[model samples]
Target: MRGEGMIKVTLVRGLAGKPEPHIQAVKSLGLKRVGQSRLLPDTPVVWGNIKKAFYLLKVEQV
Candidate 1:
C-alpha cells in the first residue's frame, strides 16, 4: 500500500554567509532556489533533513 501522509515544505531563505552544512542540506533536499517547494515523506529521516534547515524553510500542508 502507498503511504497516506506527506510533508509539504519549501525553501524560503538564502545561503548568504550561512554554514556550508546548512546550505548543503537545502541542496540535498533538491532545492536550488528560494521559494522552491518539495514534498517529502513524513518520516524521521525527512524530519531530520528539515531540522537541518529549520530556519531556512517554510513548511505547509496541501
Candidate 2:
C-alpha cells in the first residue's frame, strides 16, 4: 500500500437491511453489492475500516 500499489477489498456477503453504520462502512469502502470490489491503499485507517466491516467484506493484498 505504501511501497507498492493498491490492495483489493471485496464485499463477499449480503447486506440485507444491515445497520446504518455497517451500510455506511460498506459505502465508505466503496462497495454497493455482493461481489463488489475495489482497490484501495493499505493503511491502518483503511484496514481498520475494512476490519470494522469484515462481517460484510473481505480484504486481500494484490
Candidate 3:
C-alpha cells in the first residue's frame, strides 16, 4: 500500500544545459538520470524542489 503523504517523482528530461538550481533541485530529490524515479514524502520542502524543476519531472501522488 502507498502512504498517504508520499509522492512519486520521475526525471523525464535530460539535465544538460539546464539551470544549476534546477539541476540541484532534481538531485536533491535523489534523481540522477532521465527515466529515474524516487518515492518521496509530500512536504513543503519536497514541493519546493518540485516547483523548481517541474519542467524536468513527472510527479504523481502516491
Counting clashing residue pairs in each candidate, in order, gives 0, 0, 0
All candidates: TM-score: 0.82, 0.81, 0.92
Q: Which ten residues in a row have the lowest lDDT in candidate 3?
A: 1-10
Q: What is candidate 2's lDDT per residue for 1-62, written digit by digit as tens?
A: 44466789999988887787778778888888889889987767677777777888877778
Candidate 3 stretches greater than 4 Å from native? 1-4
Model 2 clash pairs are none
Flag the better candidate by TM-score, 1 or 2.
1
User: How displaced is residue 51 in candidate 3, in Å?
Assistant: 0.2
Pull out the clashing pairs in model 1.
none
Total backbone collisions, model 1: 0
Give a tens-digit lDDT track for model 1, residues 1-62. Answer: 12457778898888788999998888888888888889877677767777998999986654
Q: 1-62, model 3: which lDDT tens digit per residue?
A: 34358999999999999999999999999999899999899888889999999999999997
lDDT of 1 at 4: 50
Q: What is the C-alpha lDDT of each candidate?
A: 0.80, 0.80, 0.93
